[model samples]
Target: MSNSKKKKMPKGSMETFFKVLRMIGNYRFLLILSIVLAAVTVVLQLYVPILFGNAIDEVVGAHAVDFDRMWYYLSRILVMVIVSSVSTWVMSIINNRMTYRTVQDIRAKAIRHIQELPLSYLDQHSTGDIISRVIADTDILSDGLLLGFTQLFSGIVTIVGTLIFMFSKNVWITLLVIVLTPLSFFVAKFISSHSFQMFRKQSETRGKQTALIEEMIGNQKVVQAFGYEDKASERFAEINEDLKNYSQKAVFYSSLTNPSTRCVNNIIYAGVALVGAFMIPGGFLTVGGLSVLLSYANQYMKPFNDISSVITELQNALACAGRIFELLEEPAEVPEEKKEMGKAAGEVNIEHVSFSYDKSKKLIEDFNFESKPGMRVAIVGPTGCGKTTFINLLMRFYDTDKGDILVDGQPIKNVTRHSLRSNYGMVLQDTWIKSGTVRENICIGKPNATNEEIKEAAKRSHSWEFIRRLPDGLDTVLTEDSLSQGQKQLLCITRVMLCLPPMLILDEATSSIDTRTELQIQEAFDQLMQGRTSFIVAHRLSTIRNADWILVMKDGQIIEQGTHDDLMKEDGFYNHLYNSQFVNVAQ
Candidate 1:
């Protein structure tokens, strides 16, 4: 990463942390109400120790026990407890609903932003990592916001209220208790800082594990065919082990806080006992006062311990939030320009276009091409010769480093990408079929397509016969096992046919299908190509024999140009490619 890019990535987690706080702030009313209720609860709780002390004083001071007053105070405390409990429950419900809603909004926004990003962005990031951020990271925020807020409010209230009541009853004991506060805090902070780093490591490792699983599932066929089960298992085991190690470290550090705080509490208790015993003879403190002071001392350590335990959880949440924010911060691929293409005329002109994936290597140098309306232009090339890159530039999937792509004399850059793409149809070697019916897959191109229109397109693509044989016909659910590669290609072609786009780009559309299926799809493709400007990218010389123009590309430059017959007569790169295919067929 460049220094500028590194700087752009959030340097510290402070910004991401504050982002979560702001999201939680959306439910400010609930949080404020929770705080008020929690404060009242803590204030009422303090009276428990005071009430015990007063009851003890009554019994010891040779006075008749004030049972009526005792019952009144106890009844008030019980009522406060019930109200506080109800309020806390209400606060919890509101907090959880708000957290879930906020996370949902964040996920939805991330998904929408991801869709707007260019294909190049997806090509760069691992699918697993993106999925992890969207799913797992958002989940982290839920628990973090829930526990963090609950503990934070409750802890602060308890600590403050306990300290105030302790000081009011006795000064020396309060000072002794306050003296141990820093020690507990220091211990919690030490554990928190270390555990935070470990939790971040663990979260990142988990994302990698998720990515590995996704990769395996996506390429399950390849793995099984190659007999890579052992290799895949080993890879997963390594990631799993790393996750286990990091998790153990994080948990170990987090687990230390409670016990450490308790040790400090025990030391404070001993100091209070020894100090109070000496002060009792001096008439400075009563037995009941000592008992109240002891209770406050124990209550004071609880918050510190609570903060310590929840800190680990907060660290994990912060790590997840950081990953999610990083994805959300990525620059969008296609900025919404809002300028319409204004009825494209199917005329595409590429002028002196130069391009490269990496800065050190130039793929296309001064490349130029033009297709008049209704021309069947075939781009034939050896693999890795920038055939797909040419189509990508025409579609504005990636911008050319030097030169312009003009559609009907208008610069494509000036028009909105969505409007520009709406005018063209594309089919790739790999067909994508989502989990839906065959009809749904075909109508994906034009969702509002009529039944007649869909069937007509299917018939033209030669898919209607297979679709009819299925149990549900058009409604037959499409799955990997339900359709052959050729069938899927035909479905994709039918989808494009439904769109009736002004132009079409076919990238090895029939490459995976058998000769019989290819011929059937090719016939349909030829019909679809009529009266539409088409760009055919294919390795098979036989498919593009009748093209109006054949451009032989090598290393992103046109090495030869003409119809197939003309190229054969010229006996150049095109001739070489055509001859090689014939030799393979003969053998």
Candidate 2:
């Protein structure tokens, strides 16, 4: 591992612990009930050893057996045992209910918060990492919390109740137990301190492993196409091995805590026995009292043993909590302005706009442009030359760092994001088709669109012919196997045609279709762009040959702007680019 990656781990903060406590606000009554039941159960259980010791004295130690007294104590013990069993069962029910409910609330809140977070933040983090927090981490927390509530609460009650009984019977032995009690805590603290970082590392490694798996699986086609399946497998193996190592180290350190504490506890038990033996013969304590003291000693240290073992789970829960809180606390997207916009006239103006992914390197700088309504403006450039950035700014997927964009002379930022985006329809190269019927996918552009309107749009986009040939026509369930790449792009175009927005953005929209289909889709696109202002981002010079204006972009600046024929006559960059593709095709 690299040193930078091995930087100091953040301690599990009390703030995170208490914040989780606060999340149980709605389930407070159930939580309190569970605790009360646990405490009562423990108290009732403590009476077992006391009553049994008295019975031992009355039955086994006495010269003449006191049958009545023995029966009386045994009856009370029997009654207490029944009550404790019932209480323990009820407590488990209530505690689990409380834990899962609180966890459900946390998951809901986290998911909602994720939705509101900025696109920039989502782009920077892995989807698998985010999913792990929602699913895996929350499950870990639920387990730890359930264990803490059931075991920790009852354990403390048992320890405190036992100590009081022991002290009343024999102060010397009780004091010794109390003095030696800190040893268990010391062992727990030492082992937990060492293991916490390992648990944190384990969690981080698991997230990375999940991310790699998602990436590889999502791009399995690409990996196989390039014959890189072995390479991908090798990479996954490396991450999986790291997760195993981290998990092993974390488990090893946590395992040390329980056994070490048990060893100390055994010594304490033996010491108490020896002390009680001496005190009994010294005439300081009765035989029955000595027997009760030994039982109390074991009960008192039992809580320490149980808690020591649970410290590992508790620490792991805390580590998971820190990650969850970190995500919850991330800054969300800036609130959109509330101003409503009127019907857009399809005129857009970019005035002195500047932007950069990073501040150190500006990609788009002080750029200016204007498009009158109903103009087909084509933007042509090589990859990474800011064609998409222009579209991003226009759609406000990203805001310009320096200047403003205006639609129909109204500043884009001044209007609500929903209203702004509603005026434009987009069809990108990468088609997004959900697992739904064909009609459902096309109606996404206009949720309330009628069946007649949907079919009309599909017909106009040249997709209805293919849709009718399917087994169930428009009602067929869509999946990856249900359609080809070209067919998917045609469906996307059908969706946009259904909406018929005031402006259109075609970002390599026809790149996936064949030459014949591309020609048909282009004619359909011409009809769609008749009255709406359109921005066409294309590498195929043929797609923009008839554009009213063509902007030749290079390194974020507009190197040339003219009609396609005008640019071709100049025989500059645009001319060479347009001719080069034709030459390659001719050969």
Candidate 3:
């Protein structure tokens, strides 16, 4: 990937956030209600300062302070305060509910989109970073939308109402305050632009740190074996330092806005005082008018400073939004309109297939193969001879660069991926046992399988004996306290057996088991393969000795292919591999 590519993220593209908002179109009533409540609150708040100015002017003008009038003004101010407080509380409640629903919708859509992404996407990106983008980045928008939008709506309303009252009292002072407003805005914009880049850098660095930690923890055994604790710690520290530096730069720029705005506000206040002093002598400004102007100045400047602070937070949310959109925009692995294959017979065909991980280095070239409905086909190869790649291609985990693969004479490209995969059972070289009961693991392959069915499958895989020996039998939990590697492999085999797929692919399924276990499992496998089309990719020549057909592979081509006896008589690659294995056994 290029540096430019790494730095670039989807921006202002019609994102899921907007889609979520559109979906809430039916909730317009709640939204409008909140806005009305906020507006009412702001209008009421504006009256408090006006009332304060009126009361001040009345006393200063030597008007007899009537108790009834004084009580009336005080009561009116108190009523407005109560109304504003109640309305604000209501609006906040509604806003929070809307935000919760919106975030839930976003999470659901994002998760579904992630499921549609290609296997290659998962391979290229770290699990932790992807999770962080989905969980953490989405949360930024969720929390920001809740608080930021509410404050923004109310602030704008309050500022506008406050300005109107200030202009009514004394237009000149309001004009002066407006001039200072632009300066504050310009300074804020400058800070925001730099802060945005720093925030983006910070998020990216954090993602890298998350990926590194996940890699270290996932490979703890390798790290311990190699004594790489110091090296890993150094790498983590370097990423941490980069995160700290970027975060500081972002916060430093954000912090400058408040002090800068305050200095400008103070200067404006001084100008207002000087102008008011001159005007008061000429009867152009009243004492009450000056009071109102001062109140408005404070009101306007406070929110302006607040808005400046919020600009940085908005930028941070946008940076997070950009990362999330990147994942949502990734191309899906399989298109949705392909035909679903209900069931498949055992026939498989690979015709003129060619492929490569990187286009520059081809791994399979013009490969062709055909398997009958119930034949046992064993693939023999040295390491890196494209055996696994063939299986992956047949499984459609990847698309071939050239030609086509077909099952039961139907082109694989036209079939739904889910349906195509449902027809095969695969036991890979690296078996994984999830933390669960033995029965749960087996039933995963066939969710509706009965206990009797599960037990029968386990017997077929030679896994039932060990399962029965456990304290809980089929219900026994496979955990660090219970299972071994051989036991895990047996359970994996039992899981595949439960699926009972028409076609089976065993890629070194017995490689991790002991000789005695292998012999036992081999007997079970012999019974299981009776009527199924079986594809075996194995390194052990002994495993394929009884196979109906064996193909010796090299590079991207089959070097020799025949029955084991025929290959042995020919004395070629297959013969050489067989002899080498025998020599090892003798040694």
Candidate 4:
């Protein structure tokens, strides 16, 4: 019963890293080309120090200056500079193209995988967290990959090339630089590992904060109505502060890797200068050889700084990749062979159905029921009494744990979900209206609905009056903010009316509108319900008094079921609910 949240490091971080590398496998040709270009640039870069050192030897010791030799080396250096710059530019272009395309493939796969995931996964996670993985996490990974190409790869080439040139000048100096290399790596390794953990924590905290912001903004109306604005703001502030602290610590630790490695390089530089001064007295090395050794020494240490910085970026990229991989690994909905259910006969049977969100608490146990074609069945139950769960089962949003749902004598599981859901039209208590023209919103389910058909459906639902009063009639743009709650409910009803499916589900569809509007809309609903098998979950008992069958459910069991009058005569749970509402209305 403790309320503490556990911090979970993404499982299989290395495995996830390899999976992302495989995503880039398709673009290996471009990656190899970039490496070749980078190698050419590093060769030209390493030659410049050698050319300068030899020119100094030709001019420095003699009384007369060797201007001709100096000029020749300078011209060669200029040519190398231009070629190196062009090669570097070309490599950058190739690397960026490869990185972005790889990220594009990953994001598309994640989105497609999301479609195959079960609704249970979405219900457990937040909308903003899912969006963060798609947008923010992918971008972070790409940035890190790009840094690898620009800095990490090129640094390794420069370091190895510098070592080769250094050894040719003098073995003793080369050995000195080699011995100090491990010290630089030791410093980098110690600092970057600490930074990696901080970065991972920072990424997780960001996802949590983003989810909170989306939830608070989406429910601002309820927050204000309940006078909880201060509480909401305080909650947001707490998460925001947590993110700030985590980000600061991650950046601070990552920043230390560069300077710490550079410090080791500086100490090695002083050691080399002292050792070379002694070698010069014995004529063991020439002035030019000593100068070349010093230049190569600086070149060797530069990569350590570059690599330490790249390590930070690599850690961030891996953390984000871990999140993306986790999303891709989610268990998809059970795949079944597509079975065409041509046209449903609208007969439904719940045969000994049992279900539970949690195994310890059974929500629906051995529920059994049957409805004939074209029967209007009204299901009455108190809140939390498995009302919506019943509709969810029929639509195949969820499969029962132990029993089968049958439509037209065929198990629903055998039918393709797309074709099965298409045969039924639904209007829930919560209305969903996208930002578009009124015509578009009403015809979403039936895209080919004509203007005449749209107007006819709207008129039947009594929604046309308000829609026509708008500036452009059917063409007028309507967002959720533009329409009243009742008008949105009417539009939802109009959509079902337009589809005219053989089976319909209305879950408290008229709960938002006023009494007069409800009565008007109910008349339209009555007309629309003809010849259609409809299942209605209603709290207002009066609206369903004329249903062919009334099912009174309590605590996941159907205690009484018959025509409305028959249930009333029994004076059971349904009678008590109906009489209570009547008494409330009279008062």
Which residue pairs come into collision in candidate 2? none
lDDT of each: 0.84, 0.87, 0.81, 0.86
lDDT (tens digit, per residue) of candidate 1 on 1-587: 43222444332456677888787687788768778877876777777888777766766445677777777767776787787778778767766776787888889989999988877678767789899889987888778878877787878999899989988988878898888778887887787678777887888899899999999998999999999999999999999999999999998998898888778878988888889878888889888888888888777777776767677678788878888887888888656656898667799899999998775777999998888989999998898899999999988899888999999988899888878988899999998888999889998878888899998988887788888999999888877788887788888888998998999999998877788877878888888888899999988778889999998899989989988888899988889888898896699
Off by over 4 Å in 4: 1-16, 64-66, 167-172, 271-284, 310-314
Q: Residue 366: error of model 3 in Å?
A: 1.2
Residues 305-375, candidate 2: write the lDDT tens digits.
78777877887887787778777877777887579877799999999999877666779888899999999
Total backbone collisions for each predicted model: 2, 0, 0, 0
In model 3, which runs have C-alpha deviations exceeding 4 angstroms?
1-30, 60-63, 140-143, 310-313, 469-482, 582-587
The TM-score of predicted model 1 comes to 0.92
Candidate 1 wrongly placed segments (more than 4 Å): 1-14, 170-179, 268-284
lDDT of 3 at 115: 88
By TM-score, how accurate is candidate 3? 0.91
The global Cα lDDT (0 to 1) of model 3 is 0.81
Clashing pairs in 1: 117-333, 118-333
Clash pairs detected, candidate 3? none
The digit string of per-residue lDDT tens for model 3 on 1-587 reads: 53213544445423533644564565788878877898898888877888877676656445566666666778889999999999999999988887777668767878999888877678778888888788887788777677665777787887788789878888888888777777777777687778777877887787889889989998898999999999999999999999999999988887887788788878887888888888988999878778777777777776776766676666676677778777777878767598898777888888999987767677889888888887889998899999998888889888888999999999889988889888888898787877888888888778899988998998888888889999999887778648877888888899888888888899999988999989988888887787788899988888888888887888988888889999999988888888897886699
